[model samples]
Target: MMRQKHNFVAGGIAAAALVALMGLAGCSTTAGVETTGKTSWDEQGARILEKNVVFNSSSLKGDLQIVDLRGVQAGDIMRAQATLRSRDKDTLQFQYRFDWYDAGGLEINSGAGSWKPLLLTGRETKTVQGVAPDPRAKEFKLKIREME
Candidate 1:
């Protein structure tokens, strides 16, 4: 009779442990799915672009408009526009760099640093456009650096 009771207690404990393990596994899977859904480049690239570009006034700050983005088999073509303005009567000089990345989250090689210069008048707004060099570019990043 004692052996029978011991066996019953052991079986109950094992069943409870199995249930707890299954619950933990489910929670782990949910966390993994949530983490993987976010794009790797979204936060880092966006912050870099915004930090370097300065807006004199809330009204004059240029808008970063994405006109078109087409995903090709090997690469992608992204069309973007930006408007710049200065609240004070001072001319501003700026430069931009387009960084391309492959599917494996690595930056592809390009000519030099691939930087382009831009100029703006006081309280003047402007737009800019660019094209990708090749097809292996799955993603792109724009960095605007203030000069002078």
Candidate 2:
């Protein structure tokens, strides 16, 4: 009976450990900042472009700011750039990625983007750029997060 009880305890510990690992894995992708840019025509019959920035992590929002977001077309491909300002007085590292989308708001090359590293010094201002994988991209979203 003692041997059976010991085995049960060991199995329970292993099962608990597996559950804890899965929980942490689910939280591996911690959202930090997301910014979207789109192009459209306004009611004045003029062309208009917009940039929307959203911060999902309070720590990141307190440390950084998205100063400028610009998107342009180079012949047929969409190019995007974003200027970031570090508010903290210390250097920090980040990972940024660009997600391309079609005119109809569907993602292009979904789940194919790789995160590029960015380094910023104290109160530094820097710009990061991204190019679409192809010509079908008409919109873009920039995502910034703390480097793991």
Per-residue CA lDDT of candidate 2, range 70-112, in tens? 9887999889999999999999999999999998999998999
CA error at residue 11 for candidate 1, angstroms: 94
Q: Please, what is the TM-score per model?
A: 0.44, 0.78
> Per-residue lDDT of 13-86 in model 1, one digit per residue for the tens?
99999999998866642110000011234654641122223333232233222222222232344333334444
Alpha-carbon runs more than 4 Å astray in model 1: 1-76
Consecutive 10-residue window with the lowest summed lDDT within model 1? 29-38
Candidate 2, TM-score vs. the true structure? 0.78
Q: Assess the local accuracy of residue 34 in candidate 1 as a C-alpha lDDT between 0 and 100.
A: 5
Error of 1 at 84 (Å): 3.7
lDDT of 2 at 57: 95
lDDT of each: 0.48, 0.92
